[model samples]
Target: MATVPFPFSPVSCAFSRQTGIRRSPLVLALLSSSALLFPVQVHAQQANAGAEATELTEIVVEGATDSASGPDKSIVAGRTLAGSKTDTAVEDISASVSVITQAEMERRGTQNLDEVLAYTSSVSADEYGSDDRYDWVRIRGFYQTSTGSYLDGLPMRISGFTGSRVEPYGLQRVEVLKGSTSTLFGLNAPGGLINSISKRPQAVKHGEVYTTLGDEHVEFGTDFGGPIDDQGIWSYRITSKWQDGNNGADHTEDDRFYIAPALTWAPTDATSLTLLPSYNKRDGNTAHGIPYGSGIDPKTYLGEPEFEAMDTIEKNIGYAFSHDFGNGLQFRQNARYTDLDLTYESVYGATADPSVSRSAWAVYGNSRRFVIDNQLQYDVSFGRFDSRSLAGMDFSYNDTDEHRVFGSASGINIYNPVYCGLSCLTLPAGYDWNQQETARGFYLQEELTFDDRWILTLGGRFDSVTTESAFPDSGLSYKADDEAFTKRIGLTYKVTDGLSVYGNYSESFQPISADRTSLVGTPKPQEGTQYEVGLKYRPANYDALFTLALFDLTQTNVPYNISTTTQSQIGETNVKGVELEGKFALTDQFNLTVAYSYWDAEIVEDGITGNQGNKPQLIPQQMASIWADYTLPGEGIFGDLTLGLGVRYTGASFADNENTLKIKPHTLVDAAVNYQIRDNVALAVNATNLFDTEYLSYVSIYDNTAFYGDGRAVRATLKYTW
Candidate 1:
């Protein structure tokens, strides 16, 4: 059987079948935006006749390869460039890295970043349960929210109430680089960073239209791309999604709309320029937390539903340009500018009081950011040694304006609900706070290879960061400035074509949170170091990669105390762990992925006696997962059927720094089935938490709230491609 690329995708708005809800305002806006792009596409098609005709073969980067399959190919492949910012095979990179390809995300029906990385090794996602506001994830026992998240290798600056929410459909792949990355990138966490690669235009035309139906929501999406000119020098891609539905929790809505348009222009074989633009709008309510002693159910909604909503609108525009000189020398530049707006208002559970009365909180914010990076890379060989050197500099600027109000709101019963008008609540007047942060960095790296076996990498960076905060009402201001130099070294020895052993030593520095509330008078930045060793195996004849890694990391100068009277930084943390991961395509019809991790994370030193020597909250000691998929032979009338099964296990952990409250461990099961109706059409059904096991996703000490993980739910998808 021969498979063709999916056809021109049409934007869709899939409302709930049960509720018959209409399209959201956000969707309407996206549809209007789509209307504007179609004209340009039409013009491109018409201009192809007048343009000079030429034949240009597709240029494949050294380590970037496309298998026989289309854009949505199988995940078990052999090439990736995320590890080194250069075209390099994953097995050759010394760091511990994981690549989640688009094919895997589509096969698993991943709707968000959290879901896409759920089964990945050394990653913990959805720490706050099933919230749609952010993709909260931890890497190697450290938070990645503020320090370790990037888009296309550039750090995404998020301050106060502003965040960047990416649409999964617009992504080509997600790369997780474990261990300190300050050596190549700027300041970041000791655990590592996640880089998301955007979908770019392809010389070959492809498109898909799909709709997903779930327990409480429906979503429609499309992806299409092809050459815009007869000479194939110009290509374009457009992707869009619209969804409207409720979450499993009562009165919580998950509505969103997204669109991304990309264009590529290759005037010559050695040079190319691409423009990427995206827009996203989200209108959803925050997931509430329940008190431990409260009789309220985890799925119950205690807030005034009609008066609660967290809405956000964001836009991003960027361009990437690269040109190759002679003799393996290249120049590349990538830049993006973003604007974000958020409006959030909610009444959440405050106490265990059965009456469920609590204070209402509201925040309205606007933010703008700009980031750009440029690099020069050269590949050279002398005798038996090969050297690849890279030099780059990057800068970023961010500004945020926020208004917040906290006031009392009338409480309602969980079992019996009553509508309380917004008039019944009290709100503070005026916009009260503002913040801004700026950062710049310069870096250089060199990779040297000996014979065909030994590889050595050395890199260093210098960074400077500044943050400012103001309170309009109090007439107070705060400022912090930091500068640091970091370095990293790694060596890899290839034992054979299929196996390699590698080791690395790296360092990291993290400045205090830019938010005025946490800036403590130019305090010393938190510093960390790590030593890691790993083995990677890629069977020559099989489409599989297996990895094993062990590492020890320590971070010091943590903020030990923060009070109005005094602020001090005297704390330390240590994390030691081992991880194993494997993904394989045993045969044409069978695929499997397995991951396991064990971590010992503890507070080595702290000002608070009760917290010292305790395990960090929410840092589980053990995690493991396995997924297997099998495709059944196609019979007479039926096309083909693929069934997938997965299991995930999480060990117990402390709910607070004091380690008094213990969260019990739990196991979950997930299953999926895909039935191909025809060569270009298919239906898929996926379910998570199959047994409906209820477990705590997060336990907040300050809020005294417990949030539960997602319950059992099913999603069915119908897709058509050409």
Candidate 2:
């Protein structure tokens, strides 16, 4: 019944209020477009040369430079921004980072974020099986769906089921930073975070259009970008896609429409500003799995088609600004505002019996979030010692409102389900609540390099978080406030010209919502710590990179459900793992990737549940994958042809915390083939789960539900680029 103060103090309250005033979805749309009209004047430098000789000479030079946020033209990326928020070389950072470029995504024919990360080390994509609602991903044995997602180095905060969904086609690359990251980015899971770089306008002209056809599926998309003026003062890019299909499941639809427009104004090489706006809509059905050991078809639809629906609409607008003072100082700012609306309804089997009793549920929700980060970086050199210092402050506010309902549905036979309309269901009024959360953080980082051989990094962050919830129907309210400081330190040594070894220690802090009523007063925030050591190698003679990592991670104050209404935070978990990843461009015509991970996760302490020392549910001990692609040259009768193949293996895991039900291991295969008909046209075919292997991707004993992995799916695509 007591109210808590907001995280922003009086000094910062006015700033927060100004941000809250621009919550209107319609107003944001207009503002996103109007941003281009007001352009500040910038001075361009002129160069003059004098020749003393009788004969004068003229020279012309052309080249392109790579940035942390730019497109990666190759599959093997040597530098990344996600590791340190700067354009830092991968080998110099004292952490494990994996990058998946557009080239790799195209070669594998990835359709979703899950498929894009399917072959990455220390990552488990599609952990919840065939679900159209979200991209369920787990990193280092911890779920990251709610906390560890980012775009353009900014957090994509999600409350409940309201979250932003990304289009893989619009991304230039995906970077995965493994281990605790609160020292750089506040409020995150210990397993690390995934940062996706958006496709931006290019100085050169390029465009591509493609169409894909498959069984019960069809899609069309295009991406084009170029300079808007001859002097290259302005550039623009537009990416759009439409798809209609199903995920090899009966009575389910997977349809989406996505478009993103980007514009950049760079009057000078040192100063640049870019605007990124996007809209996405998805209409599909909820994922309802069959009962465990029910002997029913995996593709069978348990819910009534007439009453099942899951749909979402999301809009986002953001900008990135940077200016270099040319005095060993630089400033950067990034901000984004996101709005999401979701509607979900389903009737699923309630028991594992032959006569399935069904339960109906529906959720209607809306979420809005605004986040901003400002950074100042300075570089100074003193003799043999060089230093790069970064200082930043970030703030985020999230507001969510939801209405939930529950009812009973008529029973159905497992073998043959008789269709029934919504009239046969009994419904009642449900609870409605509104929740708001705010977080503010100030961080500082220092990177020191001595003689260009040894690198040392130190970072610290202080965060203030607050959460408030109110139940309009019950006239009850709950509030919680938390503050914490996280820190990180690392050191890297260049062993040779092409090899390096590094070690790091980092920490994380996450504030939980107040919806989970705590029996022992307010719930404490979750804290995580990790220690990691890794080795990286990049051959100077070839395009290849290899990495090996070992980490020990622990999370404390984990919450567990004590009852239907109450929870307790007397649990702790520890995960130790080893990962190996390699990317190789062995020759001009061959590319290969290999990844392997082994995780040993255990519940170290749980006073209430009495399940201590047991393995956590749904976390595998080992996962390995390999993918290879080759192109063959022919002078006659055969054009340029490419072939690709991949194999993935997921190890066994437990279904419940008690370790009673063991889920068996499974292996899957993926293949692709492409032929270049001409210089500007090509055709390709891709297949996933080539053998149609049937295995359980997830099992919930408490809910009496089990989901099957995706089946064999094949699609053919024709593309033209100019």
Candidate 3:
């Protein structure tokens, strides 16, 4: 789940201690690693210990779904919801799931998948204006980049830590399913999983445009979508966006153009299909800023122009379909094809020099990926039990070839005179990492309801993966095949009106592969488990929902090459946490939403001796966020004005398991004001980090060093509808 280096400009702040730990880092890593294998989960019977003595509710919230039976808009009716229910007892398969609404995305002006998931439990996404459009996000103590992502329950393309990439626009919601999910999905990382729901056909006609202006030649452009037919059988949406700006730091300029077009067709009452096509051409100079070891002050952090960051020219085409057979069954399918041409360069120098960081040879790579997912579901009744059953399969192939070249150290340049561009041309552009991988998988799941009161869900999956990387040293290639099976089981009970409780147990697996120059033995398939329980309450006659959940997760058989350094989870990991999220519409003009999380993660094994109780890098123990908005109900223009506020906080963390380095905790506040110019237009201004607060969080690690997140940023937008 680790992300490759991208175009992030660190503030001039430097903080970390090279001081050695009194105990062995390996020992501590191992002890902590064991935590990944053994976790204490919360179950229905234990609910009273975590909170009050609670029972189950009668109804649950239902989100939008396509089926042969068509679609229905039914809100929650005082029952346990899908996101947070804890009743039937197992482990963590009943884990909590959080959804980021489309409304929230616009308020934050999020440009990609990475930016959109930032405000969730167990999620830490850092996008401090690095060169690449892609983002680096952490969940449950593991790095989840392009590799650890999904679109509508299907995997996307992901390679190792080389070239950088980004997600496109036109998404309805980003759903975060915490903990192991291989039970229904297949071949996954243990940290957690992400499911991106694309924008679909709607009966209503809707579309919008947005424009923005900021500092350092900053600018923005956007266009939205709605309905395209009278029968409401067809729908279309388009997004056109462009950005040109200099980051808050030096040598950082974000420039790009993007186009996304999506369509949905409902030829019959029982069939629906959607097609999405996207293209993006991003050209910018790469950025390599100060490493955390130098202790550079983020305030003084302007970057050198020498390192070539991420230069990628890409295209994406995808299709999804849903069919309702009318026998209480539905089918779904998703497919995506991608093409990528990218080049990257790096400058490695002593931490002290602001200018000569490029000392070694430059690195570059090129790749392409194709993936397809198909699924079928059936809903039926058996005497006292009603069920929704699913069967699915997945397949993916990646063909990537790298080009690397050597360059002289004296060629390093820190300014606009031009280093190599982000993505290509560092050395001679022919150097090779030389690797390829292929994988295939299948899975099944079922949700059962008994006497309209007891609900049970069960699922399982299997995956086959093969990897090959060649080493030029001995003309030898190391290869490995990883095959695994995972399962999920949970129960939910509706014991009373307006309340429901649930609990679940889930498992996951990750395959292994080797590169030619690889010395890491093909590891056993990584294994993961999750246990969770929670309560959901929705009062009748009120427009509000509340949920509280507790979860414990662990992963073992992780990938590691003792010959080099142990990455995020080389051995085992244990993550336990509690989360609370709610939304309240107090009145016709006032609304509020709050999300809070507490996480405790530790490494259980490192093959070394003695490092335990150490917090995982980038995985803060405590995190919280809240937002509110209110509109004045008046007779004139004053009634059109709305005000909003948001805040997020994180606890302190150690940069590494050895605790040789440390990062301070921080909080951010944002304020917003909006006025409706008329019925279809509005102007909004937002001030983030209004106090100009300055701080840094962990990004990634190499050997014994750490990197930080971005500093303060502010943006405003003008929107119009037709």
Which one is best on lDDT? 2
Q: Against the hidden reference, what TM-scores do the models get? A: 0.89, 0.90, 0.81
After superposing candidate 3 on the true structure, give the runs of residues whose Cα lies further than 4 Å from its correct spot. Answer: 1-93, 112-114, 127-133, 162-169, 217-227, 284-287, 291-307, 348-350, 353-357, 360-363, 405-430, 471-474, 516-522, 560-570, 699-708
Task: Tell me which of candidates 2 and 3 scores higher on lDDT.
Answer: 2
- Whole-structure CA lDDT of model 1: 0.76
Tell me the tens digit of each residue's lDDT in model 2 across 459-564. 9999999989898999999888889999999999999978999999999988766665555556677899999999999988667888999999998876665555
Q: Model 3 Cα displacement at 530 (Å)?
A: 1.3
Best candidate per TM-score, number? 2
CA-lDDT, candidates in order: 0.76, 0.80, 0.58
Tens-place lDDT per residue, model 3, 83-192, is 22111221122466666655556555565565577566667666232423355555665555545677655566456434444543456566676767676666666666
lDDT, candidate 1, residue 262?
Answer: 91
Candidate 1 Cα misplacement greater than 4 A, ranges? 1-72, 354-357, 514-522, 562-564
lDDT digits (tens) for residues 1-722 of candidate 1? 00111110000000000000122343244334433443454465478758874332111111224521123245654655556777677788888988887767776778778878988899988877855566677788877676677887777756765665667777878888898888788877788888888888888888889999987789999988889999989999998999987768878887889998999999999999989898999887765777665766788776777668778898999988989997989999999998999887777655645465677777788989899999999999999999999999999888888888777676665555566878667776855778788889999999999997999999999999998888888898888888999999999999998899999999898876544365345577778899999999998866778899999988876765544444456667788998888877555566677887778887877653446677877778877777777777575456778899887877777776677778877778889998888877889999988899998876666557778898887999999987
Q: Predictions ranked by TM-score, top down?
A: 2, 1, 3
